[model samples]
Target: MFMNWRRIRKWHFLRLISMCCVVSLLMVCWEHVDHHVVSHMKSYSYRYMINSFSFVNKSLSVSQEEAARFNSFPYLLNQNNVCKDKDVLLLLFVKSSPENFERRQAIRSTWGNESYVSHELGVILKVVFVMGVHTDVTNSFLLQDLHEEHKNYGDLVQQEFLDTFHNLTIKLLLQFRWMHENCAHARFMMSADDDVFVHMPNLVRYLQDLRRRNVRDHWVGHVHRGAPPIRSKNSKYFMPFDMYQWNSYPDYTAGAGYVISGDVAAKIYQATLSLNASMYIDDVFMGICAIAAGVSPQEHVYFSGEGRTPYHPCIYEKMITSHGHENDIRYLWKAATAPEVQGISSGLVGKLYCTAVKMMLLCKPYFSNTYSCMAAFT
Candidate 1:
């Protein structure tokens, strides 16, 4: 019995040693692959990562050398051939889908084809909407609420959706350089989704007001306080259930709508070169870059999301552009703009909005140049 017990103990000990050796080997191999290989996916130097699932379909990752191209990013920023023209150029990037034709039509209807509406405040600027397309039709992980029949023919949305969007984002810069010079926009570049309903006239007026004041940090949009990018499957930009043992989104960009000043755009484009990177929720990625580039994320009075959250009628009067959630729109339009439901835009409400602005500012200084994120910009 004693001899048998000794032999069994020896066997178990040997098995444990073998397991440790295997684990150590895996760790080394993984480190080697990550360090030697994963850094080269971007044609420009910033590290760009799409989901690993893309590995099975096509080996899509940027090489380190390609990422190195951005060392002179801002310095090499392609200025417009006609850079001297002082005009406003509106850059709108739309996430295109076939099902969104009506929404697209609504946007076109809202703005009309001319792209710019010149008003006394300023040239409403030549608008260039670079639709960020996600339409290939072979996606396996894409999700859309079949809630609307209109959004039926959606884009091929998989991990590839992220990859394609990022690539297009980079390529669009080329288009921006060409257009920026010809049109001569002085104030801003607004990047956003197709679903966003920008109160264009209102935005232009606000920007004009800012320009007269010489406020340079213009990456302005609705700010989600303490909002972080989510990493669970519940999130649109989720990782695999077992892949990462972490939760929460890094401080990131909201996908709805954001406007960055042309100077800041040039800075962000440059800062992309020096940073260690983050994953592909473009908003968050942009936010990360902004933080690195001495840019501050400003929360405006009007942006919002997640249909559950809506702006009360009292809330909308002073707001610049509300995110048009259907429940809110379907009813509010009825109350204010539509025929019957009266009393939407109330009078004493203006008083409440002005009061709130002051109160909110007193508590937390308004996000003006006087109050910047420079101390904690990164």
Candidate 2:
């Protein structure tokens, strides 16, 4: 009886060890699955959360004194020679922070290289960085560095307002104000983020084509239609009923990079003064002003929105603007402007190659529902 009891006890101990091993293996598998799931969830939730925060912060009211200061403050730092040349074909305004010197420099060296565009393409492209004062009081040294950098570069347009995400609309207004006063004579104007990569050759070619076709009242980019404002309190683009009563926003181009005719730029500027500028979203506000001014946003597949375009020679040959290209701008510019690509004129074979590549790379099953190549220019 004692032997039998001992044997039973041993059997129970073995069973307990087996159970622990099973649990350990399950936990390992679960951890692997959870890592991927968590990563995807974070990426998916990041934009919504950021937009919600921006909306919530902007919803807060400023004091009477702060409002007065905001209204009365000037919106120019060094205007420089932005519009000195009346023969400027395209005026490129890049919205940058005061301390993003590396990004500005990268731009100047790559697609934003005005000298190269003028000398090589014979299209006068004036590039400037539009910015505002740094928000952090402790970052006084950074502000001073910005001042000196502006003095050396002579391409910064700064305002007196605090440079915060909630104040992006103010930045846009300042840009429009500058365009109205300083660079209105430019034939075409492009507003882009500092991180975007603008293919000057393609953009100039497109603009020149537009001029030949006499496409006036044009505001073209990646157009978002029938987009509703976020109602979630946790989203970065959340809009309260008190802030905006409209259920849907008017058709608007993505602010990442967009081009407008000089006339449209002036009209948008005028609309800003009359329309309510309480909304802090720069692109949405631009759309609102455009709607008020009777301008419609046009869709261009080459102009990317918040997302980056897939890189390929075929894609680059047609791409005008691609967002989120900080460190990769130089490489992309090189690839896009390669001699082989430049040599490929819009002929039958070239067109066929581009079409095939576009289908394979951009219109893949994975990219079908998302933003991808839609219509070829040719």
Each prediction's Cα RMSD?
Answer: 15.8, 10.1
Candidate 1 C-alpha lDDT tens digits along 1-378? 247888899999999999999988878798655433442222112212212112211221235455444221232111233225445445444444434546555555454223335543246444333332246454433323221322332211212222254344343343333334344354677655555555555566677788778888776766543332233465555544343222222233465667778788777665554442323445655655565566667765455432222334433333444454422333433333322212343356845554454344323453332111221211
Error of 1 at 162 (Å): 8.3
Clashes of each: 14, 7
- What TM-score, over all chains together, does every model reach? 0.53, 0.78
- Which residue pairs clash within candidate 2? 50-236, 51-235, 51-236, 51-237, 52-235, 52-236, 52-237
